[model samples]
Target: MYRWEQRGNLWCLNPSRPLGIVEMIGGGYLAARPQISYRFLLEELAAAGLVIRAWSYVPSLDHQGQAIAAWHSFQHEAKRSGPLNYQISRRPIRLGHSLGCKLHLLAPDYGRDCSALLAVSFNNFSINRSIPMWNILTARLGLRTEFNPSPLETLRLIKEKYVNPHNLVVRFNNDKFDQSYRLLETLQNRPNDRSQILVQQGSHLTPTSLGINDYGHNSWASDYLQRQQIGNFTKKLINWWEQNAC
Candidate 1:
């Protein structure tokens, strides 16, 4: 059994005796309700002796702003009480998926607070690539739209600012939108960086626990496959993290 609680926008999942913390940020729209969106993964981590704190937020054009807000919010919660304070005695492991990976990389503290980051399906697609119709509509209206830092600028910033480099960039074998290569390349260029990439056997949403939507709940076959995928991926992630922490 997992102890699940919601502290404002943060979702906390805890075990009776936690070995560590896995602070997470889910992908764009899915993040709006992280408790539901990441339930399976977070619970699995908790079962492996971890405390989880997942920050929930809506996607916005100002990704940088959202990044700062998420970082500060996690920091604030850690200072308050109970399992969240794990960051004080033992640094928490940061986990991010899809667009969530970019937000963690751009956090205000530059990843100094976390022990390391586990980026699953790192995605930094250009505005047009991410939202094809948006650019066309904006161009017709004589306006331009772009992420606050833009895709290229984000990589440039990572090369310059991001501090903690002990990262595991997980890329799927079939995720066409995955940008782990670019992200890992920038990170490895950093001085003393210890970043590695792991190619898994799934797609972009493999890290997510889908419900009725996205055709994930139509049949038992899908359920079995998803559970197997999530289980394998979770074991690989935690094993790598524990080995490195030692």
Candidate 2:
């Protein structure tokens, strides 16, 4: 059994016995209701002895600002919640999916907040790719909403600001939207970096269970094979988090 609570933008979960804390951020809009879509993944982590604090947000034009806000929420909530023993021994491991990965990388104090980062299906798409064609056209014709740190700017900022040593980036085979390789390369730019990328046998949405409109709702996502694949990924993540927490 587990307990769930909401304190502003975070969803806090406490299991019967927790091994560590996971500060989780889901991709873009998915972050708004991560509990509903990531039910299986959240449960699996809890079962493996993780107390989770899932941050929820809808991205605005202010990329850096959003990242900073999320980071602050993690710190304040971790200090306020969690068992005293767990708090003293371990910093929450940062877990992110897709755009959430980008946010974590851009977080102002990312290096100091968590022990390591576990990025699943990391993505940073161009404005044209992320928004509808109509919106793109509108933006060009005067209706302007800046994508603050554009994809290129995001990479540049991460290269300059993020300096965490331990990082595990996961990429799904069929995730066309994923740019984990680019992220891994950026992380490797620093000397003696211990970042590693793991390729799994699933799509971009494999880490996500909500199942989007049509492409994500296919039998492939719900089949036994896919379930086993995701389960394996979750197990590996839990093992890595436990083994690496100092």
lDDT of each: 0.85, 0.79
User: Backbone clashes in each candidate structure, one number apiece?
Assistant: 0, 1
lDDT of 2 by residue, 59-110 (tens): 7767788888999998788667645445446777889999889888888885
Per-residue lDDT over 15-98 for candidate 1, one digit per residue giving the tens place of the 0 to 100 score: 777788888999889998887778778888888888888999999889899999988878877777654464445688999999
Error of 2 at 111 (Å): 2.0
RMSD of each: 2.2, 2.8
Which candidate leads in lDDT? 1
| Model 2 regions more than 4 Å off | 82-88, 143-145, 211-227
Error of 1 at 237 (Å): 0.7
TM-score of each: 0.93, 0.88
